[model samples]
Target: MDTQADRLAGAATGCPYPFHRPAPLEQPKELADLRAEPVVKVLLPSGDQAWMVTRYADVRALLADPRISRNLNRPGAARISKTNKLFQDPRMDPDPPEHTRIRRLVMKALTATRVERMRPRVQQIADELVADLVRQGPPADLNETLAYPLPIRVVCELLGVPVQDQQRFRVWTSSFKSISGSSEQNRLALDNYMRELIETKRKSPADDLISAMIAARDEDDGRLSEYELHWWSRLLVLVGYETTAVQIGGAIAMMLAHPDQFALVQEDPDLMKSAVEEILRWKLVGSSVTMLRYVTEDVEVGGVTIPAGSSIIPAADSANQDESVFEHPEVFDVTRKDNIHLTFSAGTHFCAGAALGRVELEVVLATLLRELPNLRLTVPVERIRRDEKHLLESFLEIPVTW
Candidate 1:
């Protein structure tokens, strides 16, 4: 298969800097070496250069820094992808006051209270998925049967989007987030689909998040613009399902690989909360680095002076494994205390759907542990393949049997 890595003419190597991982479950090899320097220049897949921060304190500090902006459309901002302008899109990264306003409306729409109320339904969904997987017998792809389907269904129901449209949603979202595909086309398709859904909800509303967001917009009158509503809806649908879905497969893989840690959770289900946190910390989605943030003014990161307009990648995955913050940072300890991973990020841009994502993951893991106690991977860890078509380092299939 001709991947982006293969096609890029002058893509740099050796630094192996950005998204290069030694194996499916391994962290990027350069992470430890990069941490020694703390901050260093690395070339991206797009053939653009940016500074990446690996230490926990530095990553957390960068995430919370007000001077660092998510709006990467600036003239001097480093391009994340040659084809995928998803990062560079203005609608995707709005300015402060507008960003603040959209976040406020989103909070009003997808409140923690509302997410908590869906706990029962979420659990039921997990139960049904497990039951179905069992009924279908063994040698099944766990990702297809469980991990991939669960979150999409949950998000679709939450947003009042049709669960029937899940297949199309999956394709659109995969393309939308793919580092290898035409990001602009996929993004437009997603945006158009979302706009149509919003219009449909406008005509005939339902008791769902989208409907609620629409109501919030109408009641406030320009507090949330039409474009903001559409953009937020599209983004929510994408992240709401994609990241959690990828995390489920990765988390399950991590647990199965370390039965001792899995045993801890099995022995005491109360450990599930911390276990989930550990999974979040340990899980590597794709690139350790997340969305690039352009500095608003001169900033000092890890003793290095970064001038205004320089792009920086705050590596939360690398931070989660920092030796300074986490003891035995290499080990996957389920009982590890104060497991403050930056998977959901920090500060103003913290994930809005985090609570809901947590609920889904907890339910999926707990239910699987209880119902499929003997579940084991049918293939060796290294034999498993990655879904390289998408940006996230997720499995193509997790073949498992009980």
Candidate 2:
């Protein structure tokens, strides 16, 4: 792999190639155009630094490299200043040390075994939700009824929120996250919301992740600060639903696109495993861009030299679509022999919610596949639309006639 620094100094000028990997719904034309350049470089609206890593190999190497820290809390790190509450919190703050600590605590409550235990409940939710849709007949908005609600339901249970309160949580949860939002307003609202939830949980605890974390923090003799716990709780609640929402909707859309593959999965329930993996790989949700990294030390990726502190963005979306890794990468093969996609990522910073996500998606898809045996898309593929601009890469509205 070549380091970005080894390439000509003036490579990615003025969004040269503008080679950012696009949403599953849209591919930026510059993706291929930027092949000649080391990586795409462009100044942000606020004069921040950014470089889009488009090649598969470079993206993987950069993401896995320790020198490239996930810790956005480092000094001179303006990349994360794009958001207020985001990098300010330990979650998106520093890499290692604090990042490791917060991740461990969250994972303690969210392990693969723990997540798997919730599958039956997830399937139960799926059944009831799908039944309502079946009664309603065709022309149902799958995104609203299915995609959005399913994750919300599961996460609500996981976090011990009363089911009826999910909608308020959703609005409160989304306010801070939106890119177009006023940072101070969203942050204050989020803090207020989290503080209220924490106070409520303190008065009356439940058998859920939030309670467990509070207990753990106490037993450790105050290893977790009030702020950390609050931030963790709010973060877990929102993140638990956000990515899963993207994957579930994306998976169903992928399945529907290929009728034979969709039918195959519907027939052989075992095939859902491969089907889900394929769906994650094929759909590159564009808007959820990982911030470009500041390479603390010089490094080589995809045969390019990256200088220290350069804004190096790993193209997870691009790596998932790489041809060498998956046979017929673009063909949407449900039974792909080698499905080692970087969807969950790898190493210490791997997504904490992945196991839970897999379980939720698998259960919901299984229930939907079996129940709506004749389920099909009501809208044309073109009209189906993909949310390239927003974070979720959502379907604006998935119109399904099941």
Candidate 3:
């Protein structure tokens, strides 16, 4: 078996194909070039060779293949960084019966019907945030004013987290997402906090997702273990807000950057449905791959054989931009029909909160456009700063004036 370093040395002689995950708004040229290859060998931050599957068909196939497992604890699993190994979620890593059991327990709280029931509340939260932004006058940071707060408030309410404690949770969660030195430390702190919250829910259950999970029983009349409860709660609270927040920010930034499309949606509210879908398609919120899936057996993908235990990353960004699947893939057309983007990922690991995230985006975008029809960026697009440390790509601050 060739080591990742040996494979890299033997395969390509030139400088390792530079795989810089693009910034939030920037198109990833390196990924586009990688898509042309049968299978691109790229070095991870961990200095391990992982296959980057960039084509739409290949990524989809890779995701659906049972031979590829998301469990990072497996030997030879591809990791993004050393710190990432410290923060694995059981809900995300397990395969089959175990994963199925965990997903079923959690899905009871996040079903489409339950999420749709929260739509009015989501809209109310969005309206309030937009109203506050308007009251604050022009030159407001939408990222802070709307993007961050709306999702945070909604998720907290749904999870029974005290809205007053949001600021503290925000700080801890920010550190959890950071690529900085303190990320692990913050992750541990968040874990401890969630543990305490779980205990609280156990003793005094409320009508929230956490409490619902606390009382939920399986078909066999089994309850979630303490460990399962802790990790799932943490995953719910962190991902519940983090991903949706980024999408909201990305959608707004993309729309404001392209005023023509923005005006089109603003003129007719009915287009909001397509606009939301296109925004999800066009935006690159998450990483090139959500998590590294290790091959459990020899698997052929994209005309290349991935050996057992080798790590492979499915490039969702490249898949979204695949020419075969999307026409004029570069253009952010709101009217795209049959738009199928991998932003929320695909297959069994597809985001459980996707439906909720969509509703949140729809409400927020429609509310913002209606309330602030004249919204425009205060600074040049190039001047916008992005958080380089976090795994997800998004503007740190989006100052806009209406």
Candidate 1: clashing residue pairs, number: 1
> Tens digit of lDDT per residue, candidate 2, span 306-390?
6877766676665676655656665777888668777776676677787888888788788888888777778766677764334
Estimate every model's Cα lDDT from 0 to 1.
0.80, 0.67, 0.77
lDDT by residue for model 1 over 1-402, one digit each (tens)? 533323331234324346566777777655665677666666766777777787899889988788889988789787766767765666555557667777887889898889999999999999999999989898788899999899999998998888678677787788776666555666678788889999999899998998898888535535567887887787788788888888888888888888898898999999999999988887557775455788899999868898897888898877888999999988888999999888888888888988998898899999999999988888788777887656676778888888
What count of clashes does model 2 give? 15
Report the lDDT tens digits of candidate 3 across residue range 214-320. 88778763767788877888777778787788888888888898899999998888888889988888655756645567889998875678889888888777788
Give, for candidate 3, the lowest lDDT window spanning 10 residues: 13-22
lDDT of 2 at 132: 88
Alpha-carbon TM-score of each model against the true structure: 0.92, 0.87, 0.92
| Model 1 Cα RMSD, 1 decimal | 4.7
Predicted model with the maximum lDDT:
1
> Which residue pairs show collisions in model 3?
none
Off by over 4 Å in 2: 1-29, 32-38, 42-47, 73-85, 88-92, 182-187, 217-222
Q: Count the backbone clashes (under 3 Å) in each candidate.
A: 1, 15, 0
Global local distance difference test of model 1:
0.80
